[model samples]
Target: HNKRVAIDLTLPEHLPVLYADFKQLRQVLYNCFANSEEVMSDGGKITICAQELAGERLELRLTDTGPGVADDDLKLIFKKFFTTKKKGIGLGLPVCRQIVRAHNGSITLKNNPGGGASIILRLPLRPLITIGHGRRTNRAA
Candidate 1:
């Protein structure tokens, strides 16, 4: 199953990272990918991309070539414990939202351009600080 789902990852040249829990982030991403795979069932593709935006913000996008979400469900996808799947506990997306918001970031879900679903995560990147002998520099905007 892992071999069938194509995963693509892209990151910025230089990214400023805020105080984020890496373990939680990994869990969120893993859950997203797992959900996508479940929806695909027969097999499909998944792509993850990240880029640095202006004002020290980072944009992370996850797209899946599976059945897309309906318009009505879009607004409620992030609600705590709300899920459309019959077998799901529905905590995945809500947990993801919580983790992102905890870091002063935001997450949104939408239908992909052609077909399938897309999850977009926007995070405020922290600036870098450099210090030297009697000199200090702030890399955050």
Candidate 2:
């Protein structure tokens, strides 16, 4: 859309690395930013904050300044083929959720009390790596 979208990134210098599929994770972030851009056609701000949660997981909050999502649509946002945009096929969020789940993470969306919407993603810092006999182990990468 050629919109001027400003990104506000907040992350600690010593933040731990997450163990995940690089390509899939990048796609998730890209899809989120694309969604924000599509809603803010004129221009807007996207605030992204990343932090460690009790040394167990990483929490990433992506808040957009575009018009917030509707209450009724919130439940259906992650459902396949559910979209509010005229040109959107509604696979973005569903795919994002799927990718996140594949990494043993979770993705959620909620409207900001002030305005716009926020997408919260939580991923384990040490993703479980399965071994023989269904044994699992955590190794941060």
- The top-ranked prediction according to lDDT is 2
Name the lDDT value of residue 49 in candidate 2.
98
The superposed Cα distance between candidate 1 and the true structure at residue 37, in angstroms, equals 1.3
Q: Could you tell me how far off, in angstroms, the CA of residue 134 lies in candidate 1 after the best superposition? A: 32
Across 79-100, the per-residue lDDT of candidate 1 in tens digits comes to: 8878999898888999998988
Highest TM-score scorer: 2
TM agreement with the true structure for every prediction: 0.81, 0.92
Error (Å) of candidate 2 at residue 79 is: 0.2
* lDDT score, candidate 1, position 75: 87
Local error of candidate 1 at residue 74 (angstroms): 0.8
- Distance from true position, residue 119, model 1, in Å? 0.5
Model 2 misses residue 48 by how many Å? 0.8
- Candidate 2 positional error at 11, Å: 1.1
Task: Give the poorly placed runs of model 1, Cα more than 4 Å off.
Answer: 12-18, 127-141
